[model samples]
Target: MTKTGTRNRINAGAWLISPPAFFAVALLAVPLAAVVLISFWTQTGIRDFDTALTTANYREALSDPLYLQLMMRSVWVSAAVTLVTVVLAFPIAYYVSFHVSPRRKPLWIFLITIPFWTSYLIRVFLWKVILGYSGVLNTGLQWLGIIDDPLTVILYNVNAVVITLAHAYAPFAILPIFVALEKIDRPLLEAARDLGEGVVQTFRRVTLPLAMPGVIAASLIVFIPTVGDYITPRLVGGPGGLMIANMIQTQFLRLNNAPMGAALAVQAMGIVAVLALVFVLVLRKLTRRLAQ
Candidate 1:
């Protein structure tokens, strides 16, 4: 196209994108700016707070050993959820993508998303019922004579949080991997086979490499929000399962420390950002090495 035509098209594109851009800025950027600003203010009492700027919130959060441990545990739990969810999701996505008929793919995808129709809170509570001491799992095990008594290890801990989060986020992981798998050139695998590469070898060198983007995306989807998840940790996590989000909630609600809560939120965001950045860099390097 001519320069004038191209410029006009560019202008039109910008106009089309402007609405979502403005919405994002108004909703996300503005609220985030407010949060950062509030994090520096001083909380004077339960109902009263001052606009006086201070770094004491950050100092206090970083200095506290309990907060530090909770942050670390949150990161660890998120990582575990990402890992387990992706691993479970990959096979299902692969099956649906490669084995299912194209005409039926939509049905399979619809089934995968059926869980989303329910309230997330309800789903977490459902997990509590399923994993509770006298819940479905324990009852079933006892009926089968697999256990002499109801297992106390099933709920109210980090393990329960991880299991519930993994199940909750499984759909998020599957869709991305399915999309990535769908984009793979079938001829690449045929070429590998013709060159005498075994099934496992072809998958390792061809399929897995090409699909890394989706896997990374799936991991990020599970990890980022799971790190901030307070409800699951609150409902089923109990004492040892408590994460950074729970601590942040305690500050805002129970402790009545809004400034400190805001500070904790900011620190959590920073930690998540740093973790995402490191994952991207490491994945990029790995992709390059594999390419070479």
Candidate 2:
């Protein structure tokens, strides 16, 4: 209430907030600003500096068929991963939330999260070993007389990319859906049963509607990162499996075309952001209608 006390309180509040604010600017904003700035200028070499601002990079990236195709492929692959993860996770989440005893739920959840405790790169490489020409799958299939020859289709392709990304992000999809399902009141289902609703009808009317937000959240979490992912595609994707991020990498690292690479990065982020916004908006509208 006193002037000195009020001043001290204000200072303390600022101090409390300042660290995070400083961290955000230092870690996020500054790097992002640098990328944007670099995107506008053409690069000649690793050490060469040219500060001339141009739209040539953006124009070339937008107009190039190869880049455009890669971008489309990226979108398609990420969308597929999101869809598959959500569909698979929903049933698991449903079973865990409704059917399992509370005492054992944490154990099941921990098992679900166990894969995440392992190194991601190691897990991915393990898939490579399993899916390779002389890998366990091929060897087993051959021994079982299921296949006469090694299958090259499993290692480096869009299918491999989808499989890897889906596995990697599956936990992300599950947790949100599980949380949403757990938050639902049990009495709602009981009330539905009391009103003579069938099991499928109750789920359709009560459970699915309430779980839309989690579905949206999970889809965004999986899709957005998958779209921007370079590692999975690099490790699993063959020449034909190259996505937009791969192209961006080549532009920056191999081609030494920083401006073009930056343009591609910016474009990828922008497109994903717009799609995410649209998804969130649609989900919000649907949630409102469901509430009504």
Candidate 3:
């Protein structure tokens, strides 16, 4: 090509890529950079920003039992939600992907996604009513003489948080698994069957291994959001339901300690990132072995 033509092509390629690059830098990278910078600084309760840099926020967060406890609780709760959602979603996804007719697959997938069209807060509030002492479940149970008094144990606890999150994120878990399961060739299952493998053995050896990527993807999606979630715990978790996100909110808004809040936010993000990395690495290794 001529020099001018080559130059024109180069400019066109740069123009095509520049907008997204600029948007990412402006929207994502810059904000993340600011948060990292602020995380290293110090802030008094009265001011929003402090120019002084210190390790006090990180130290305080690490040393404080309440913060540490909340962090651990967040991890555990998120893990539980991810596990439940994955376990429940996998079978539904598998059925829709492999067992159902192609004509019916879209319908089943559509039904799976119907819950997401509603407001998340409203859905959670509905659960609150169902689980509440004077709510439908309690009323029904009392009428049937299933129990004498109302059951307060159903709401305002870690279990409530887990249940709500699991329901909310189930679709997220299902879709990825469906995609992975759908990608598997039918002949592979036939090959296993032809090799004298039983239904359970074929599934264990062929299907589950093929679906690991989706499992990892779904788990990360549910787990990451659950860790950073403030709403589910705030509304459902009365006292023991508080997570690290709650503390981060308090520091940022109530105490006006932006720097400290940023620090805590970074700490939480770092922990999640590390865990996600480990999960992805282990999943990739397993996938490689399965492929072999």
Candidate 4:
């Protein structure tokens, strides 16, 4: 093609993407830029902000022990939720993708996503009822003579937050894994078996490596949003389960310190970005080593 024709094609492609590009900038980029900009400003009074740029918010957000504790709690809670969701999801995804009949796979996937049909708040409340001292789980276990007293550890704490978040995000974790497992060529598994590998060995050498991409994807999907999750932590998390997001909420609303909240939010985003990057890099490296 002539340079003019190539240029026309490129221009046409740009024109086609311009609408979505504009929306992305308007909806995502602009808001994010506004938050970052606000993070550098000073809160002088309730409903009052100094437009002059300052770093005090960032310094306090990072250095304050309470803020640091909440930040770390958010990180670990998110990590725990990610681990549980992915681990449980992998088996379900594997079973549906590898063992279930292809004709029935869609039905199984649909069933797995039934949890999403309900409102998220409703689901969290349902979990609260199930995990409460006098809740279904405790009552059932008591009836079965498994425990004489109600369990207090499972509700209104970090455990509750993890359980609720894990359950909420389970479908997100499962779909990616199921897709990855589906894409695995059955012939490859057969090849591994023919080479005298056992079930565990074949999976370790072949299936797990191929499925790492999905696992990584699922981890990121669960980890990123859960860190910023405020609702679940609020409803079921109690005082102990309150995360950095709760503090951020307080800063923005109750405390009337939007700048500090923005700084905290930016810091949280930075931490999540760094951790996610490290996670992907490490997982990819492990996958390469496993493949080799």
> Which candidate comes out best when scored by TM-score?
4
Ranking by TM-score: 4, 1, 3, 2
Q: Candidate 4: lDDT of 141?
A: 100
RMSD of 1: 1.5
For candidate 3, the TM-score is: 0.92
> Could you give candidate 1's per-residue lDDT for residues 1-292 as a string of tens digits?
9999999999999999999999999999999999899899998887888998999999998999999999999999999999999999999999998899999999999999999999999999999999999999999999999999888776999999999999999999999999999999999999999999898888887888888899899989999999999999999999999999998899898999888999999999999999999998898788667645
Query: Which residue runs of candidate 2 sit more than 4 Å off their true CA positions?
Result: 1-14, 285-292
Report the Cα lDDT for candidate 1: 0.94
lDDT by candidate, in order shown:
0.94, 0.90, 0.90, 0.96
Give candidate 1's total backbone clashes. 0
TM-score (C-alpha, index-matched) for candidate 4 = 0.98
The ten-residue window of minimal lDDT in model 1 covers 283-292
User: lDDT tens string, model 3, 51-131?
Assistant: 677788889889999889999999999999999999999999998987799999989989999998999999899888888
Q: Quote each prediction's TM-score.
A: 0.95, 0.92, 0.92, 0.98
- Stretches of candidate 1 off by over 4 Å are 1-4, 290-292
lDDT of 4: 0.96
Among all windows of 10 consecutive residues in model 3, the one with the lowest summed lDDT is 43-52
Ranking by lDDT: 4, 1, 3, 2
lDDT of candidate 2 at residue 142, scale 0 to 100: 100
Candidate 4 on 1-292: residue-level lDDT in tens?
9999999999999999999999999999999999999999998988788999999999998799999999999999999999999999999999999889989998998899899899999999999999999999999999999999999999999999999999999999999999999999999999999999999988988999999989999999999999999999999999999999999999998989998999999999999999999999999999988877
Best by lDDT: 4
Clash list (residue pairs), candidate 1: none
